[model samples]
Target: MSTPHPHHFRPATTHADWTKTDQYHNKYLLSQDEALEFALKNTDANGIPLISVSAAQGKYLYLLAKTLGAKQILEVGTLGAYSTIWMAKALPEGGEIISLEVNPKHAKISTENIAHAGLSSKARVILGPALDSFPTLSPSPPFDLVFIDADKDNNGPYFAAARKLVRTGGVIVVDNVVRNGRVADDSLQTTDVVGVRKLLQMVKDDKGVEATTMSTVGDKGYDGFMYILVNEGI
Candidate 1:
């Protein structure tokens, strides 16, 4: 075996530092409360994949929901409900949030965490493939915001459904689209990256939505989210 590169030793540490500083800045300037802290602990205790959005990202979601005055929100992934709790806190009185999760264990823990946050009345965790659950979700009032954070391999389908479920003026946010910058390379055809590219193409082809993608570097390493705004008139 060849000798490992010296740069490999510092990357993880450097990434951790990046996340720490990002979190500190967000927390010092903004604030994340204890409920989010307990939800993170719940995720760890349940052995769920610690893949929930970072605190800063969670706060961003919360603020976005509040800014939108989102009455009905949909989350495509409910991993331990850390982000779920954050977004749910933005709901107005009588507002509701529906979170979809494929893993029953994850749904169970998400339900527990949401309840622990005193949001059970406003939030519900559905156990099923998001594709399957989407059909049953109502589009009556339509979702003011839809957050897609599930399996990246199905992002195209999720966005397609989100378009149908969101109001004309609503917003859709798909996370982890950048995947450490792999998304910029056309030769790499990983399913996750391919799905994101397909979704980008769909957005480009559809004139009803205005969309943009942004890259982020933090504790989650390098990744990004796509923000799509649905405009009136298809």
Candidate 2:
């Protein structure tokens, strides 16, 4: 008998499987918290796109910030402040997070959500294009962590701007980079894909930062994040 393709021996997993796994992990790994649930519910009630990170992903961001002892955070997107709330909660007593949102509606809703989470003291939502807001932050302390999750077309610009504001040894994370693995295919010239490709090339060419990408699958489906660490020499 001829040998079968290796695929024949492996079990196939579907979106349902990924979702179930995410739920399973959330059940055991996350604790009940009213503020976080309210953030999700309020965002949906306000008709904001439910594109914020999943519960597991939010917790992951929280843990990352907590582990880094991040005192200052700069967030490029503040959709409903879901992820913002998570990261803000990880800050120290005097730590602060400045989140930027281009949509006035989103900025308003996120501001409300942050206040509801009792994190208004730790987080602030700035309404405007991130590029416009970046200049205003020049006088502030360098951010220890930066999260970029806004328009894909501006990914390159956002990364470049963030690199300048982040402290040496700081971390910068870009979300939704893989786009279901389309990033590797040059034939796909979608703006989002093209943006990610360009950002990847920029990172590869930059000697001041060390970076890596991680593929993820959950209730939100397949996507990935890019993590870049600024070198001390820079």
Candidate 3:
């Protein structure tokens, strides 16, 4: 083992600190939104899991889609449509996003939330497994951005499908890849961690894409996203 750099070594930040920082950033950078608040409240009322992206992360997704001028987007999961609404709000007229949800309850609630956000014209939630929906998406317009946040155990398959669905120069984002840092520990072989590892290995062997992992610490604890840009020439 190599010696660690003394100046770089430091105690890990606590979850409380991480949450405080997220709150601070959200208060200053993310303005209050009635639609989003309502969606969250409705989700809670319906007993849906509150695993949607944080405000800061949602804004990041929004900005990413806006920056790309994405006309078509695909989301592998639609939990209450919180993130869907965020990204949908960034779309221009005629732009559309299709979100897939395996759970009927989640899909129904997501549809309602999208309508509540006044984004019904731009965002649609499909009730079905993402793998099944992927096949039906063919022959349609290629997606400019694909966000995969569904069951982690199927991440490798999701990435493979996303590669075929997304257009050249498009981006694919896989969330919760770090799984509280368990992904890197050999002893931690949870299904989620193994799925992420498999996706990483596939990305490593794929020469047609450029990809990187970004580790994040926030209210959601330690996790990360794997971002891949499809470029056949690369």
Candidate 4:
């Protein structure tokens, strides 16, 4: 787990957001109890599961998908299958989450988790780098939502790919946008921070895309993620 923020800056130990808790801020949505339990159980035993997107982050993305009436979604990372379940559980009937995982072993575990959640049909685990598998989906379905939570170095390229996959009204969310609050400070030299900075710049400068970034403090740290809401005439 790569924690960019220290303890002093962490999100309040108390997660006030119902969306982040094991409970849901909204009804008609599956309680995250089962999914979160699965993540905690697997994360501690599996090591690096330490670096996963918080359950709050996953729930936030899931809520956005539901709001957008997303029928097709593409996720760049499927760590422990926690996020995969979050996204899949929120989909409308026939909605699907096509998640990408770099490691075959991780993908296998995610497959089991998805099945355990009874969402096997709603989610498809892709076993490879997103860059490799993403481009292969010729004439891809118009993804209504795209979530990027994998390697930080490829944010720009992934955003480019995400843009192509999503429809005009679709949304693209990249986790870890705050990068421990390092992005705002130009002196930082870490590759991940720099990469995120570039992506933010892209979002700000693009005229064709309209976006709004929400800044928040959470239990993890001063760091917060951003969501790029793409309104391609939608």
Candidate 5:
């Protein structure tokens, strides 16, 4: 008999179950509050896609930034400014975050939301295609951390750009890298999958980055993220 493929195995928990359990635990551990709900409502009222990171995930980003003591952060997507508000709250005085958004409408709405969150001074939404806007960005002190949660089809290029923008010892996080575990299938070569694979290969080829991917199942489904730590002298 032939050996079974790893993908054939059943998961111990369903995505819905995991999301519910985790979110519940997160509320207890991380102190769930209303500010995030307010942001969601702001985006909803604006007719923006209800696709901002989940409450638990937003908290995770906030904690990560806080742990890094990040002074300059770069975020590639500012959907509802939900995540922006989370990270901005973690910033110390004089710390700032630049978030890139493609849609002018989205940028405007995000700016309003950021201001509503009382983070207008620390978070700024740059309006334009992230790929085009990246070149114009000249962080005075270089980004201490970078978060890419934009178009998955261009993850490879985004990763390249983020690598250049971030300083040594900085962190780079790429969201939705797993794409419901489609990344493991060689037969499936969708544009987003191809882009993710290309980025994985680039990380493998580049010695300067110490990277790893973690698979996650949440309310958004079976997507995951890539975490990278930039080594010195790159």
Candidate 6:
């Protein structure tokens, strides 16, 4: 085993920290609460405000889908289906995306949102435990790209699952890695942060992949960090 670089050990981005800063998360990451509510009408929540992903992350992933010429993609999380729209719309002609969510209400709303976006033909919304379903997932992954944004505790399992599903040259993008920069500090024991750090290590040790974590983009505010793991490059 190779020794890990000092910088690879960092914290995960906690959703809690993001919600604390009114201006940071509200105006930037998740900009359209009202529109999101309308778009994600029945997505497992109160409808006042939704748990959509950061705009920065959503746009980035969408661009990656186009850039990678991704035809088949899998996302671990589908909160209200807000992020699914960004990904599904980016799929190339005949391309497809399958998103998994545990919440039945959110799944129904997401299905509706995809239809509203006129992308039902290219997207599939599954309402069940992604963990159980992941092992049985077939057509043998080699998925062009995979995004991990679901439960924090399952991140390591998701990482292992990513290795199994993504193609040799594919990419896996894990979100919210730089939570409040508290991840950089060792004192914190938040589930996601700790889990993300461990996940980073697994990717770093795998000689078959190349990886890096990027902090937030638009604002100096901690938008989030992504660990881009690519197989076949190393």
The parts of candidate 6 lying over 4 Å away from their true place are 1-49, 217-221
TM per model?
A: 0.91, 0.94, 0.93, 0.82, 0.92, 0.77
Where's the lowest-lDDT run of ten residues in candidate 1? 7-16
Better of 1 and 5 by lDDT: 1
The reply for model 2, stretches above 4 Å from the true place, is 1-9
Off by over 4 Å in 3: 1-11
Worst 10 contiguous positions by lDDT, candidate 5: 27-36
Select the stronger candidate by TM-score from 3 and 4.
3
Clashes of each: 1, 0, 0, 4, 0, 4
Candidate 2 — what's its lDDT?
A: 0.93
Q: In model 2, what is the error at residue 175, expressed in angstroms?
A: 0.1
How much does candidate 4 score in TM-score?
0.82
Instruction: Assess each prediction's global lDDT (C-alpha) against the native.
Output: 0.89, 0.93, 0.91, 0.76, 0.88, 0.73
lDDT of 3 at 144: 89
> For candidate 6, what is the TM-score?
0.77
- Candidate with better TM-score, 5 vs 6: 5
Q: Candidate 1 at 223: error in angstroms? A: 0.5
User: Which pairs in model 4 have colliding backbones?
Assistant: 10-221, 11-218, 11-219, 11-221
Candidate 4 lDDT, 14-108, residue by residue in tens: 44552354343333443538766776577567664556666566678778888988889889988788878888888978778899899987887
Per-residue lDDT of 93 in model 3: 98
TM-score of 3: 0.93
Q: Order the candidates by lDDT, highest first — what do you get?
A: 2, 3, 1, 5, 4, 6
Clash pairs detected, candidate 3: none
